[model samples]
Target: MTMKKEYRVKKNTDFQAAFKKGKSFANRQFVVYSLKKPEQKHFRIGLSVSKKLGNAVMRNQIKRYIRQAFLEMENEIQNEYDYIIIARKPVTEMGLQEIKKSLTHVLKLSKVLKA
Candidate 1:
């Protein structure tokens, strides 16, 4: 299943806002930038997988894994923020479960994921 459009952060301005004003947290595989948006009723996420990581297929795979992770963890994640997730080189060596673990670590560091 795909994430709903309301849960995606699609605009360049939105990504930039998160980068500029949000608090950031990082682990070996990912960087998470989170900005609280009290007016928003649900969380929204933007993903960044650089070309340096891989070609289109690999990048898309990484994105799919991330979206899936978020979908699975939706109930545990806070719903009043905007999040920008940036993939790191190390993520290229990981599988879906590893990716989810790494992402969960970063989100925890940011205190956005409930214990």
Candidate 2:
């Protein structure tokens, strides 16, 4: 399933807010920053894959994998938080399952997944 637009963290201001105030959780493949906003009804997710990691195609591939993983785990995720997933160098070589595992680990560390 595709992630809905409203569930995406699309603005620079939102990214800045999350970055400035969010708590972080990291693994070998990803670093996730989370900011809880209890007033919102759903989670908002942002992804960052830098040019330093790879070329455009490689970056987009990682993003697709992340989105798919997030989509699969959306129901288990806690509501009202903004999540930013930053890809690490190792992430470029990882497959979807590995990415999912890393994402899950970070989410749990940040307490953004429902118990």
Candidate 3:
């Protein structure tokens, strides 16, 4: 079977676009920004982990968790949206499934993923 390539929003401008052109919010465990990226026909996602949350290892852990969650759920998601996920301090204590649920919840609330 052919693999599906996941798209990522990597440029700083893409994050800026999500904040400026799209809607955003903060939950108890995460902050989410989402918008439609007309430049893409599929979905793209980005993740953030500030040093304020921890050292390099902690930050990388959070990034990895979010990225995997995004990849796994990207297919079931709606199209044309660019999403940015920022992990809060509490996120370090969460399990992968919890992270996935939070990501899915925010995306759904943003209406980037249709129910």
How does each model score on TM-score? 0.97, 0.96, 0.85
Per-residue lDDT of candidate 2, residues 14-70 (tens digit): 999999999988988888999999999999899999999989999999999999999
Instruction: Give the poorly placed runs of model 2, Cα more than 4 Å off.
Output: none
lDDT of 3 by residue, 45-101 (tens): 787888998899989878778888877876777777777888888898888899888
Clashes of each: 0, 0, 0
User: Top lDDT: which candidate number?
Assistant: 1
Error of 1 at 90 (Å): 0.9
Candidate ranking under lDDT, highest first, comes to 1, 2, 3
Score residue 19 of candidate 2 by CA lDDT: 91
Superposition TM-score, candidate 3 onto the true structure: 0.85
- In candidate 1, stretches whose alpha carbon ends up further than 4 angstroms from where it belongs are none
Misplaced by over 4 Å in model 3 are: 1-6
**All candidates in order of TM-score, best leading:** 1, 2, 3
